[model samples]
Target chain A: MKRKFLRRVVSGLLVLSVVAAAFTGCGSASASENSSKDSDSASYRTLDEIKESGTINIGVFSDKSPFGYVDENGDYAGYDVYLAEQIGKDLGVKINYVSTEAANRIEYLQTGKVDIILANFTVTEERAQEVDFANPYMNVALGVVSPENAVVTSLDDLKDDDEVIVISGTTAETYLTKNYPNIKLQKYDAYAEAKTAFENGNGVAWANDNTEVIAFANENPGYKVGIASLGEQDTIAPAVTKGNETLLKWLNEELETLGSQQFFHKDYEETLLDTYGADYEETLVVEGTK
Target chain B: MDFNVINEYIPLYKNALLLTLKIGWQGILVSLFIGLIGSAILYFRIKILKTFIGIYIEIFRNTPLLVQLFFIYFALPKIGIVLSAEVCGTLGLGLLGGAYMIETIRSGLESIPVIQRESAASLGLNEMQSLWHVILPQAISVSVPGLLANVIFLLKETSVFSTISLMDLMFTAKDLIGMYAKTIEALFLLVVFYLIMLLPISILGTILERRMRYGQFGD
Candidate 1:
C-alpha cells in the first residue's frame, strides 16, 4: 500500500514537472511571436521617423575600445561612437547608445532593442541571413596569437592535437571551424575569461579579428600575434534587422558619401593608428562603402 | 533550423556532461576525505591545526566561489603555478568543500552526547578508539545528507570551470548557442541536464536521512 502511494506521488510530480516545462515552453514561444509581430511589420521608421521619435538607439560595445567602450568618466566614447554622434547630428535626432556584445548584435536589431549594431560587428554570410548589412566601413583581418614560446605562425603549423581558443560568436570561430575543421577548438564566451585561459596555457593559440589580436599582443608582452593574417579580407559593417530595406538604403547612401570624404580611413588614423602603430594604416584601412 | 543537427552535436554534449560528472565525483571524494580528516582534527582539538582550521574555514566560507575561481585560474598562473582548467576546478572545489565539510562535521560531532564518550572511557577505550568506534559511526548518518547537497552544488559549479575551457555541460550549451544563435533551446536543455544530475542524489540523500531517523539513531 505504501509503495503504491509513493509511486503515485512520484508519477504525479513527474506529470506536474512536465506540465510546468510545457507551460514555460509555450510562454517563451508566445513571447517570441509577440516580439516578432510587434517589430517585423513596424520595420524601418526612417530618418524622419527617428527625428520625430527624437532618439536613435545605436548599439555599440561597452568593452571594445577605439570602436566602442565606456570611458573613465562613464561616457560612451569610441570611433564608432564618435560616428554615431555625427549621424545623430546630421539627422537631428538624439542618439541613445545601447551597449551590446558580439553575441547579441543581430538579436538586438531583430527585436528592435536597437536601430543598428555598430559594435565592431564583422559581417559574415551566416549572420547576413538574419540581419541586413550596410557597406563595409573597415576591412578586418583574422589573426592568431599564442604565448611567446608556443607561437602559432600559421594554420598549417598548428598540430591536430592542439586546440585553438576562441571567443564564441566572433568571426574567428566561424572562420576557424570552416577553414580548419581538424583543429580542435576550446571556446569561451567572454573576453576576460578567455584571455585568462589563454594566458594560463588552456589552448595552443587564440584566434580573433586582427584588431583584437593586435590589442592583446601589444598589451601583453608575453604573447605575440604569430599569425598576423589568417584568411581573406573580412569587413566590419553596420547592420539592422533583415527586411529593413529603407534603413539599409539610407545607410548605404550615407556610406558612399562618407567614402568620398575618406571619413572612415581618417577615423582609423585618428583612433586605431596609435594602437596599431603607423605600419598598418594603408594596408588595413577600408574607407566606407564596400 | 535543423533539429537533426543535434544528433551530430550529441557526442560533444555527451562528453561535456560526462566530464562534469567526473569532476563532481572527484570533488565529492576529496570532500569526503577532507571532512573525515578535518573532523578528526577538530575532535581531537589539536594544538596549531585547530587554529589554522578555524582561519581556513572562516576565509573560504566568507568569500565567493567566483572570486576563488578567478584567483585560481589567473593568479596561480601568474606565479608559475600552471594547472589545467579541470585540475584547477577540482582543486578549488576540494579546498572550498573541505572548509565547508569541516564546519558541517564539527556540528555533527558536537551533537553526539558526551555521556556516550564518558561511558566508553569507563569501558577502557582510548579517546581515538572511542571517536572511531562510537562518534563517527553515528555522525556519518547525519553528515551524508549535507555532503550530498554539497555534491550537487559542486556539480552545478563545474559549469563555471567551462569559462576556463573545462568542457563541462554548461560550456557546450554556451558553445551551441553561440554557434547557432538558438539561445532558448540551448539554455532550457542545460537546465534539464543539471536537473538530471542533481535530482537522483537529492532523493537518495533524503532516503538516507529518513532511514537514519529510525528509532535507534533518532534520539
Candidate 2:
C-alpha cells in the first residue's frame, strides 16, 4: 500500500509539473498577444502627455562604453547619456533611464518600455521602417580591430581558416555574414565578452562600429583599427516608436535647436574628446542643422 | 499568438535543437568522467589529491558558470592558452557539473555499510580489489539516480553556453527574436523545445530513482 501511494504521489507531481509548464507557455503566448493589442490600441503616450507626467523614458546602453556605459560610481554616463540629459532638461521632464541592449532597442520602443532610444542606434532603412529615427547626431561605420602584431587590414588579409569576432545582433554581424560568407565568425552576445574573446586570441579581429572599435583600439594598447571601414557609413540617431509623430517632430526640432548652439560639439568635448581626440570631433559629430 | 512565425523558423529551431543536444550530451559525458575521478580521489582519501579536488569542487561550485565560461573563453587567452567557444563551454559545464557530481557520488559511497568493507577484508580482498570488485559496483548503482539527476541539471545548464556563442537553443531563440522581433513566439518555442529535450530525462531520473529505491529496501 505504501509503495502504491508513493507511485501515485510521484505520478501526481509529474502531472502537476507538466500542467505548470504548459500553463506558463500559454500564459506567455497570451501575454505577448495582449501586449501587441495594447500597442495597437492607443497605447502610446504623446509628448504633451509625457510633459504633463513630468517624466520621459529614455533607453540607453549600460555596457557599451563611451557611448552609453555605467561609470565607477554606478551611474549611467556616456555621450548618449549626456544627450539624454540635455533632452530631459529641454523638455522639462525628469529622465528615467532604461538600460537596454543593442538587440532590444526597437522592442523596448514598441513595447512602450521607453519613449526614446539613445543607445548608439544606427539608422538603417530596415530599422527606419519599424521605428521613426530622429535627425542624425553622430556618424558611424563598421570597422575591424585586430592585435597590433597581425592587424587585419582588409577582407583579403584574413586567412580562410581565421574567424572574426562579432557581437550578436550588431550590424557588423549582419554585414560580415552577408559579405564574407566564406569567413568564419565568432559571435559573442555582449561587448565585454567579445572584447575578452578578442583579447584571448579567439578571433583574428573584432568587428563593430568604427566609433566603438576606434575607442577600443585607443584604450587597449595592443589593438588597432586596421580595417577602418567595412561597410557603408551610417548615422546614429534617437528613435521613437512607430507613428510617434509628435515625439519625432519634437526630437527633430530639438536637434536643430541644439545644433545652433553647437551642443553636439560640446557633447563630444565632454564625453568623447578624451577617447577620440580633437581631430575626430568635426567628422564624428553631426550638426543636425539640416 | 502568431504561431506562423514559429512555424516559419522551424528549420532554424531544428538545427539549434540539434546543436543544443550535441553540446548537452557531450557536456554530460565529460562531467560524468570528471565526477567519477573526483569521487574516486575523495573515496580513497589521498592526502594532497584530496585537497586539490576539494579546491576544484569549491571553486567551480562556488562561482557562477557564466563567469567560469568567460574565464576559460576570454581570460585564459590573455595568458596564452586559447580555446574554441564550444570547447570552453563544454569544459566549463563539465567542471561545474562535476563538482555537484562529486558530492552526490561521495554520499553514495558513504551509504555503503561498513560491514561490506569488513566482509571484503575477511574474504582476503585487498583495498584495490575490494573497491574494484565489491564497493564500486554497489556504490555506483546507488549513485545512478543522483548522477542521472545531475545529468538533467547539466542539460539545462548548457543554455548558459549561449553567452559564449555556441549556437545552442537559447542562442537560436535570441537570434530568431532579433530577426523577427516576435519575442513571445521565439521564447515559447524555446520553452517547448527545452521541454521536448528535458521531459524525457526527468522521467528517466524518476524511473531510476524508483528502481534504486526498490533495490535498496526490496519493497
Candidate 3:
C-alpha cells in the first residue's frame, strides 16, 4: 500500500513537470513566430511618433561603469546616460531608459523595445549591417590590464599557458580569438565577474575596452592598464533600427549641432571627469563635426 | 522555427551538457556529505554545535544562492583566499543544498515512531549503536524520496553557476544567443538540455522510493 502511494506521487510529479515544459515550449514557439513577423513588418517608431508620444526609449547598459551603470541610488547615470538625456531633450520627448546588455542591444532595437542604443555601442561592420549608426560620439579601442607586479604590456608577453580574461560577446573576445589564437581565454558573461576573476588570479591579463580598463585600474589599486591599446580604433555611436531613417537623420543633425557647442566635452566633464581625468578628454571625445 | 541554427550548435551544446553534469554530480557528492554530517549533528542535539549548525543552515537557506556564489567567487578574493570559479560554484551549491537537506532529513527522523528507539534501547543498543543500527536505517528509508527530490532541485540550481563564469549549460546557450542573436532557439535548446538531465533523475528517485517502501512495508 505504501509503495502504491509513493508511486502515485512520483507519477503525479512527472505529469505536472511535463505539462509545465509543454506550456513553456509552446510559449517560446509563439514568441519566435512573432519576432520573425516583426522583422518583416519593420514596426519601429519614427521621430514624429516619438515626439507625439513625448517619450523615447533608449537602451543603455545597467552594469557597465563609466559608459553606463546604475548609480548608488539605483538610478541610471553614466556618460551614455548623459548623452541619451540630451537626445531626449533635443527631440522634445521624455526619456524612458531601457536597460540593455552588450549582447542584446541589436535585438532590443530590432524588436522595437528601444528607439535608440547608447550603451557604449562600438561601431563594427557586422553590427552596422544590422542597424543604422549615427555620427560617432566617442573613440575606443581594446586594452589589457594586469597586476602591477606582473604587468602584461603586449600579447607577445603572455606565456603559452597564461589565460587572458575577456567578457564574452565583447570586441576583445573577437579580436583575440581572430588575431591571437595562441592565447587562452577565460570568458566571463559580466563585467563584474570578469574583474573578480582577474583579481582571483584566474587569468594573467584582462582585456576589454581601453576606457574600461583605465577606469578599473583607477578604481582598484595594485592594478594597471599595462597595454593601453590593442586593436583597431573604433567609434562609439548611437544605433537605430535598420530602417529608422528619419530618426537617424535627426541624430546626425543633432550631433553636428552639438559639436558646435562642445556638447560632448561638457558631457564628459559632467559624467566621466572623475574616473578618466583630463588626460583622455581630448583623445576619447569626438565632436562629430564632419 | 529556424532549428538549423540550433542543429549547427548541437556539438557545443553537447559539450556544455557534459560540463553541467560534471559540475552537478560533484555538487551532489559534496552536498550529500555535508547533509549527512549536518543532519547527524542535529539528530543527536549536540550543545554548541547545534547552535552553530542552526545558524549555518539559516544563513545559507535564507540568502539567495547567487549572492552566496558571488560572495565566494568575487568578495573572498579580497581577503587572500581565491578559488577557481568551478570550485566556488560547487561549494556554493553544496552549502545551500546541505541546509535544505538537513531539514528534510530531520523531518524524516521525526516521522519514525518513538517506540522504535525505546525498543532499541531496551535491546542492549547504546545511543550511537541504536542510531546507527536501528534509527538511521528507518530514517533513511523514509527520507529517500525527499533526498532524491532535493538532488533533482540541486541539479537545476547548478545553472546559477553560469553567473560566476563556470561555462555550464546555461552559459553555452547564452554564448550562442550572444553570437547568433537567436533567443528562442537558444532558450529552447537550454530547456531541452535541462529536461534531458532532470527527467531520468526524477524517475530514478521514484524507483528508489518504491523499492524502499516495498522493503519496509513487506507488501
Candidate 4:
C-alpha cells in the first residue's frame, strides 16, 4: 500500500512536470506569434450581454495619468476614468476598470479580461485588423524627447548602439521599428518603467504619443522634444472585439453623433489641456472629436 | 514558431545560468556552515545557546524572505550596515536556509541510538571527543542526503533574490522577455537553467540516501 502511494505520487509529479512544460511551450509560441490568429478568432461579447451583466470592463493604464492612473490615495482617477464613467452611465451599466499596460491591453481584450480597451490605444492598420475601432476621440503622432539642448530632426542621427525607449505596446515601438530599422529599442511594458529606463541612460531618447513626450519634457529639466513628430496623425480610439455587430453599429452611430456635437474634443481640451497647455495647441490638438 | 528567439537569448540564458549556479553553491555552502554551528547548540543541550538558536530559527523562518532581503539590502544602509548586493543576497539566503538546515542536521544527529553514547561514555571518550569522532561522522553521512535536498530548495529560493536587482536567472529572463515579448522562451530557458542545477542535486540525494540506508552500520 505504501509503495503504491509513493508510485502514484511520483507519477502524478511527472504528469505535472510535463503539463508545466507544455504550458511553457504553448505560451512561448503565443508570445512571438501575437496577432496571427488574433484577428480571425477574437471573441466578442454582445452589447446585450454587457448590459445584462451591468458591468463593462475597460482596460486602461493605472500607472499613467491624464488618461488613466491610480492617485496617491489608491483610487483610480484620470481623464480616461471620467470618460469611462460617463460611458458606463450612458450604457446604464457599472464600469469595472482593469488596470493594464501597453503590452497587455490586446491580450486582456482577446482573453475577455476586458470588454473594451480605452488605454490610449492608437488606431493603426495592424491593430485595426484585430480589434474594431470606434472612431478616434483623440489624434496623436509618435514623438521623441531627449535633453533640452539636444536637437534631432530625424531618426538617422541616433547611433546604432543608442536606444530609443518606448512602452512595449505603444505605436512608438511600431513606428520606430518600421521606419528606422537601425535604432535599438529599450522597451518597457509600463510607462513608468520606460520613463525610468530612459532616465537611467538605458536609452538616448524616449518616444510615445507627442502629448506624453511633451509632458515628460515639460516636467523634467534638461529634456526637450527632439523629434517633435513622426508619421501621420494616428487616432486614439475605444476598441472592442471585431465581430460584435450590435455593439459595433451602436458604437459607430453614437460616435458619429458625438462627433457632430464635438463632446470628445471638448473633453480633450478639458482633460488634456494641462498636458499640452496653449503652447502645443496648434500641432498637438485634434480640434474635431472624430 | 522560430527557434531564433531562443537562440538570440542564449547569452542571457548562459549568464543567468552561471549566476544562479554561483549563488546556489554559495548559498548552500554558507547554509551548511551555519547549520553545523546551529545544530551544535541543540546537540550539546547548552541552556543559553539553545535559546539563541531557537530565536534565530524562529526569526528567519517566520519572517518573509523578501522582507529579509530588503532589510539586508535597503534597510541596513540606514544603520550603516551597508553590504553589497552579492553579500546581502547570500547572507539573506544563508539565514533562511540555516533555519531549515539546523532542524535537518539536528534530526539526523538525533536519529542515533542512545546506547551508542553510553558505549562512548564507557570508552573514556569525553562529550566533545565522542561528538566529534563517533556522532558527527555518522550524523553527517546520514544528514548529507537531506542537506543535498535543501541545496536544491535553496537554489529555487534564490529566485526571490531577483527583486534586489541582483540579475539572477529570473531577472535576466525578465529583461529578455521585455525586449523580445517572448515570455515562454525566457521562462523555458530559466526552467532549464534551474533544472540543471537541481536535478543533479536531487539524483545525488537519492544515491546518498540509498547508500546510507544500506551502509549506515558498516559491516
Q: Of the candidates shown, which would achieve the greatest DockQ relative to the real structure?
A: 3
Residue pairs with backbone atoms closer than 3 Å in model 2 (clashes): none
- Residue B27, model 3: Cα distance from true site in angstroms: 1.4
Global CA lDDT computed for model 4: 0.74
**Fnat, 2 decimals, each candidate:** 0.29, 0.29, 0.28, 0.05
Tens digit per residue, CA lDDT, model 4, A83-140: 6776788889988889987766665666678888888888887777667778666668
Tens-place lDDT digits, model 4, residues B40-140: 88999999989999999999989988889867765666666767567877888888999989999999899888888889999999999999988887887
Ranking by DockQ: 3, 1, 2, 4
DockQ of 3: 0.39
| Interface CA RMSD of each prediction in angstroms | 4.0, 4.3, 4.4, 6.9
Candidate 1, residue B111: Cα displacement in angstroms equals: 2.0
Tens digit of lDDT per residue, candidate 2, span B5-71?
Answer: 7688778788888887887777777888888899889999999999999999999889998889878
All models, DockQ values? 0.35, 0.33, 0.39, 0.17
Clashing pairs in 1: none
> RMSD (Cα, Å) of candidate 1?
3.7
Candidate 3 structure lDDT? 0.84
Q: Per-residue alpha-carbon lDDT of model 3 for B1-219, expressed as tens digits?
A: 466877987788898888888878888888888888888899889989999989999999999988999899888888988887778877998898889888888888888899999999999999899988888888888999889988988888887877787777888777666655666678777877777788778766767887888767864
TM-score of chain A of 1: 0.84
Report, for all candidates in order, the number of backbone clashes.
Answer: 0, 0, 0, 2
Which candidate would rank higher by lDDT, 2 or 3? 3
Instruction: Give the alpha carbon lDDT tens digit for every residue of A207-259 in model 2.
Output: 99999999999999999899898789889999998878889999999999999
**Local error of candidate 4 at A185, Å?**
9.6
